[model samples]
Target chain A: MFFHIILERNLQLHPRYFGPHLRDKLVSKLIHDVEGTCSGRHGFVVAVTAVENIGKGLIRDGTGYVTFPVKYQCVVFRPFKGEILESVVTMVNKMGFFAEAGPVQIFVSNHLIPDDMAFQAGDVPCYETSDGSVRIQKDSEVRLKIVGTRVDATEIFCIGTIKDDFLGLTGDPGGAA
Target chain B: MASTGGEEEDASELKLGEDFLKAKCLMNAEVALILEKKFETLQQLSEDASSQFSQVFEKSLQYVKRFSRYQNPEAVKQVREVLSRNQLAEFEVCVIGNLCPETVEEAKALVPSIAKKDRMDDEQIEQMLADLATIKKYE
Candidate 1:
């Protein structure tokens, strides 16, 4: 899921960057330091939408650095367990397949895949049914239920399953274009 | 923190824990629109060296562009309106908008919380699906 939320961060600026463009420097630095980072509380900080406030700067005597508290709104993507998500398959192997829903990587093990679909090995590995009507391969869009989520300091991993009703290939494979 | 709702972390029940219960949920279409506009202005401001974005930003841009069912802002807004008019929760509204399920059954399956005893009936789910389909058709 994507959330638009306000987050606070304290940014440290070197004394040399204190000038007319201090605000710009601060905002840009905030974006540079925050975007793409993942926290256990917030899954992934995708983008910084707007800077709400910048607190009064406090200078450190030893390092000649200024610490300014910044509040900004950003878009974050977090996958919760039991949430149904549409993802694109990124790779296929005997172990299972790895799919990505935005920044979250979900691994669907063979046990999670429907029993009818068997793994096929070749140059382009995939899992397909007997009739071959439904296939899961690289770039195939699928709707799956997140069974588990592991949120780390810098990464979020998930285990998904496409074995339930209404959860499977969403679109034709290799036709994302 | 105190457990005000006293609900467990269950997406099927729409009890999305305390951290996300009140957070504003953004659909893929809304995200796509926001990112595109932000990217355009960011590009204009930083045309030189520091313009490259982070992996999360880049990946999210690509993902939203690829998965967003609604291509235009108006369609996105209308989808939200239709869902809101039906009294769906914030999370359900975005999930329905993002998935664009074709049938009421599928919608219920995808978001089981809506199927809870008194929340929504089949007809209401059908109507919502039809409304969403219309937006996608005309979008």
Candidate 2:
């Protein structure tokens, strides 16, 4: 999910950056420090859309540098439970398959797949039906539901399933679209 | 054995999201084949439904087909989540998820309680509609 959020930060500015371009310096520093970072409270800060307001700068005791309070609006993307995502299957094995959607990697355990399909072992492992009508392997696309997730600063690992309706394979390999 | 056009899920794919979901169901061989041909993506159910429920299944089989508006159950589920998170009422979320009201006035019509509608801000309602637009493709 995406949210428009406001966040505050105290920016410590070098004395050299205290000139006419101070605001520009502060914004660049803010973007560099804030963008692409994640916090457990707010999720991922996708981008710094704008700096809403900059409060009065206060000088620190030991250093001649100034601390400026910056309030900014940004776009954030956070994954939540029960969020269904359409991700591409990356690897298939007896256990199940791994798929990546955007920055998130989700695992669909074999146990969660529909009971009709069977796993086949090969140089490139895949899951198929007894009749070989449907198969899931690397590069295949699937619609999966997020059952659980573990989000870290850099990436997300999710436990997902394709056992529900309107999920699974889209088109069989030999079939015409 | 797949080329997941992702959103263009066949019948079997849609069926995964539901369970004997009461609708225009089918027990006849020809209807099964029609469903297979039309929604080839859906997994055909096993022939052995509990004997006790077979009669009830047969009675409701005729209406098992998916409606054009609600063709993608995944989209419907997503819309429901969006509504619930935005503080929309429970029954209202179900109604909106089904009807998928695209505007505030339209949503107010489906959820007749003006007091409930007054609780949600314009942005929350708009975001709900925007989310619904993404899932309108199952038809």
Model 2 residue B33 lDDT? Answer: 30
What DockQ, on C-alphas, does every prediction get?
0.50, 0.02
Q: How close is candidate 1 at the interface, in terms of C-alpha RMSD after superposing the true interface residues?
A: 4.5
Against the hidden true structure, what lDDT does model 1 obtain? 0.87
- CAPRI rating of model 1: medium
Chain B only, TM-score of each candidate: 0.89, 0.48
What would the per-residue lDDT of candidate 1 be over residues A1-177, giving only the tens digit for each residue?
899989999999998999999999999899889899997667899989999999999998899899999999999997777788889999999999999888889999999999999999999999999999988899999999988777665888889999999999988775752
Model 1, position B105, has a per-residue lDDT of 82
Cα shift from native, residue B124, model 1 (Å): 1.2
Leading candidate by TM-score: 1
lDDT (Cα atoms) of all candidates against the true structure? 0.87, 0.57
Deviation in Å, model 1, residue B73 alpha carbon: 0.7
C-alpha RMSD of candidate 2: 19.3
Error of 1 at A53 (Å): 0.8
